[model samples]
Target: MGPTLDSSYEDWVRVAEGVVPPGRHRVGGREEDGAGAVFAVVSPRDGSTLASVADAGEKEVDLAVAAARWAFDSGPWPRLAPAERGRVLLRIADLVEEHRSEIAALISLENGKPIAESYGIELRAVAGTFRWYGQLADKVCDEAPHTDPGALALVTREPAGVVGAVVPWNFPLTLAAWKIAPALAAGCAVVLKPSELTPLSALLLGRLVDEAMEEAGVPGGVLNVVAGDGPTAGRALGLHPDVDVLAFTGSTAVGRHYLRYSADSNLKRVWLELGGKSPNIVLPDAPDLDAAAATAAWGIFFNQGEMCTAPSRLLVHSSVAERVTDAVIQRAEALRVGDPLDPATEMGALAGAARLDAVRGHIDAARAAGARLRTGGAPLDPAPVPGGTYLRPTVFDRVTPDMAVAREEIFGPVLSVLTFDTVEEAVALANDTEYGLAAGLWTGDLSTAHTVSRALRAGTVWVNCYEEGDLTVPFGGYKQSGNGRDKSAHALEKYTELKTTWIQL
Candidate 1:
């Protein structure tokens, strides 16, 4: 059992002040001063100031990058045996688990995710990710090829040096783990820039890392964290010539900027897990309409629809479109949207006022474009959760493929409903999006499931379930959705460079 958290704003402020001290930046295993520019971290839960911390700019970013580079070039991290590194990572994972309750509380207070989800899904995944990569550290091996009698050839993978990771606000700690754990396991030093919107958890993670590394005898400067916005700190890390790799998870627009930065600078490898407007297709042969409707609502409304792989666009066969749409509306309306800390709440506030406004704009645009509003279309009254940025789940029926609401990534609990007459049409509709991170299909026929899954351009295809999988499966996107996979053994490829050695006697 873990310590109980007080969800009141005053109590949260007290906790946050202690967890994230002022002028926080972890460099070389020590708390360092960041650039004098401080940013107020506002809680989307009740629009209150949680705390203020120094924001990293170019100067601070330079310090962080230099620390990471020094750690890689002259420090003991890369020189350590693979098994030793694995042991250190395992220790870090244990520390994360020990602090699970506090982490979940911070996420709920800062990022506006439900406390239950922050614990059950986000924090649990963060610890599991570290454990998974920790176990994989010693398993990575070199290969020897059978060659000519006079020659010997060996292929090996080596760390890519300093890795600059820029993570987003949604599931901040979990996404950071996706990049940081793998990079560390591959023997790379890291300079992580967590999103300014929610830096508390990542800052707390830095503290945990410092303690774990100290306990495990891992050297200082192996991991540095910089908290700031994209323009200054993120760009500095991206363009730093000494930084050998950049791993980013955010919007596609920002992902493209990293590519340009890579081209303009050292041409370091960039791995991106970007935006998605994923489709959820419901066929006439769907196993069960009730189950499908429930899954659809959960898919979009979960995390307040801020997930990159959210099933925002729902496609149904004409025969069952009305039935499925009605059922989905019923499910959405039944969801409890209130204070995130409340255990009974199914959904919570948006990350900020900007997100709430963006969702409302999308709803208005859809209505003007002649789409039928089947359910919620406005922000919830502040009476339930005063000052919180809350919105009721919205469903737009009779939405065309060409509508703005259907085409854009709204990043809210807004569902766009479209109908298809045949399997071919469904496939076409699902493939029409510029983003292809993920897609889902509900069908009883195995052939239809297999055929449609293969036809979809998404990186992940869910046949009967939505957002299903574990750490073993690869997650990424195709086309404009971005490049490079995150999770599973496939993720290790991005953090290392391959080299071939030949010997002739």
Candidate 2:
């Protein structure tokens, strides 16, 4: 009925173990030793250490930045013809597809997403992103506005030089691909710093980049990856004077830090795709109330609810609130939560122990504030392995706009249901959040869909659907959700600088 697994869990597990080694960094196209400090790559499925990776620091960041600078200034990547570069990226895409099973397994272990989702969604996005950007590499056209015959004007674009891409633990490889593919397509060198919690997938991706580059007969050092926590290595990258631009996908707080980092250092262009408390509204006139409720449940519970654009806030029309909320609660409770490696699991563990506790704390705060605990709110046992953390899908009804659960991004499998009586109230409630990444509404009325969608302040609006998008459409947000698009041809703007030349006739 859905996307089937390419292989069994045991088969993927066997492939994951051999994907990459511990304490490795890919710098200047070579595997190099990280300084002595190290951190454990703890699997959220089980607290056991999958590998001990280098606890990257200032030294590692400096080395990676230097390598990227060199590559940008005097390497084959930036000098290659756009088509030639696209060929390399196509090779990378092919390689990714070839090793899809391995990367999927790695992501499931490092990030606690189900193996099926990892294979079907994350890895698929990664390969497709590279392929899309690759095909578009030579397709971008520079512009020159028409002028009088006395003057000749020309406009051109150049790579922005070194880019520092810092990604968080959730959807590690997928987010990395979003930044790397476009930056590379624009001929910009990159230094990637992956979150400490889930660095293995990114590390493996760096190796794959090198693999593709080697086959294309191109020089290395175009892309470098370093693994570490946010403060040490991430800050170093942010403050590095050599980085020409930085692209980050994480929390709004961290996005603010990167802004400050740019201001304090080179004043590099910083493009951020930050947090979201996206709202999914269900109107009384929805074409299919059943589908809307099911999608609402899926949106909040998918990926253990770690998505930036997760529909955490559910706004329903008063006329059908009870029926829709009950349907969603049923779906949430019925979701299969267990080992991430299981092919049949619909939900999986949180990142680790700390994440589990943080989610619990959010639930407790919601309870303290007097929100109704509708269906699921508790943590399941350490399953499949000791120390594994799985939280049951949680739903909070009768939630007020002022409540913590409704206002904050819990980043867990928690949904807050709020109600609206009229179109004006629904519009106000949806646009009330500080983060405007995405929003969805379900209705059958043509005018209502058009008018309401036009009124919503979110970057992407889906009518009668949720989280459905292709690579052609861009994704980003309005106000606090951060700046710039992550997909489509516009993403290249983040990695390139525009230059104008004017000559007298």
Candidate 3:
């Protein structure tokens, strides 16, 4: 059911030797030398250096963009039939499934997610994304508009030239797939920049892409990857004049920067999926209180609360606040924070030391700002998992709407509880923050559920659930959480531009 994280370094070394090439960047369908600046890929689990990877500078980014541009303009990729492109994407999906174990291992080891989650959720999503987009490739068609009897009008969707995709560290492979699969399926060339913190899995994906392209007779220079920090590679890709579109999933701060980059440069199309402080509302209804409590715990504690759509703010009806808070505290305290590689571990380390320090700062700030510490505020001892960046799952009660903990995105295993007396107050409290990414409400009244779901400002709202959805549904955010959708047919629109052609008979 889950992968065993007990695999030795020697075991991973063998796999890495095969999956990751000497140079991480794949340009023009081959591995190429990166910039001389090399950075260590440090593991958050025990703070070990897994490997050193080349950091892509402006020069490397230029090369990648050029390759993508050439692929889009003169290469065979865009010229291929939509059905043929679909077949190639299907082949890529097959290869990803074949190497699922290795990809999952790399993700857990590099990003500090539980091995079980890496295998069960992340890897599976990666494969499924390609398949979904593959199936959709041929389905998209041009429209023949109703026109005058003597005239004909046609509207078509064409691939936007080079697509520059920059994905964050959390859920690296799955998020990358969200951008890459659709871009390629739309017959666009891609130059992907994976976060430096978790480049291993993306680089491994490059191998699969290369193999699949060769097998499917797809041309070289269609897919390129450059691993580096956001400032260099990310900025270069954003500001590059030839790049027709940019897709990014990261912090709101960086998302704004890309918008500025587009304006200052060629005004390329920019799609962003950014930060969130999503709220979870528990109402006094006919549903079981125990189940609501468990769901509340899962909303915040899952993935160590490092999710952009994490339900960090829990709003419970005053009548059941104490009961639900108690249940959530019990569940938080019971979570096991240890080795990510261990199959039994429910929670793992933060991505790195920087993230660990950031989470601790938020915890201290919340306590000082008058939030009551309910359970598990202290960091875990390092004795069991030496050198690992482990933090305790924390829950704070008696939190007010204006408190810093409730307002800001801590992005850790920190949950803040607020009690509301009326539905209007609950909606106000939920929308108090700048984020509108997601929200969850648990209630037995069908009318109340529907009413609150519509009233919430978030892009995605769940009734009696949290973070439940599939590729078929569109996922994105509203307000400061950022712009544009990630999954579904809506995502394809971001990779392609619409054109109209009119003819007189």
lDDT top scorer = 2
Candidates in order have lDDT scores of: 0.89, 0.90, 0.88
Clashes per model (N, Cα, C within 3 A): 0, 0, 3
lDDT string, candidate 1, 134-195, tens digits: 99999988999999989999999999899999999989999999999999999999999999
Q: Supply the global lDDT for candidate 1.
A: 0.89
- Which portions of model 2 miss their true places by more than 4 Å? 1-6, 16-22, 382-384
Assess candidate 2 and give its TM-score to the true structure.
Answer: 0.98
- What TM-score, computed on C-alpha atoms, does each candidate reach? 0.97, 0.98, 0.96
lDDT of 2 by residue, 130-179 (tens): 99999999999888779978998989998999999999888888889999
Name the weakest run of 10 consecutive residues (lDDT summed) in model 1: 1-10
Q: Residue 129 error for model 2, in Å?
A: 0.4
User: Model 1: which residue pairs collide?
Assistant: none
Off by over 4 Å in 1: 4-23
lDDT of 3 by residue, 51-168 (tens): 8888899999999999988999998899899999999898899888887767887887789988778877898899999999999999998999899989999999999989999999
Clashes of 3: 3
- Poorest lDDT segment (10 consecutive residues) of candidate 3: 1-10
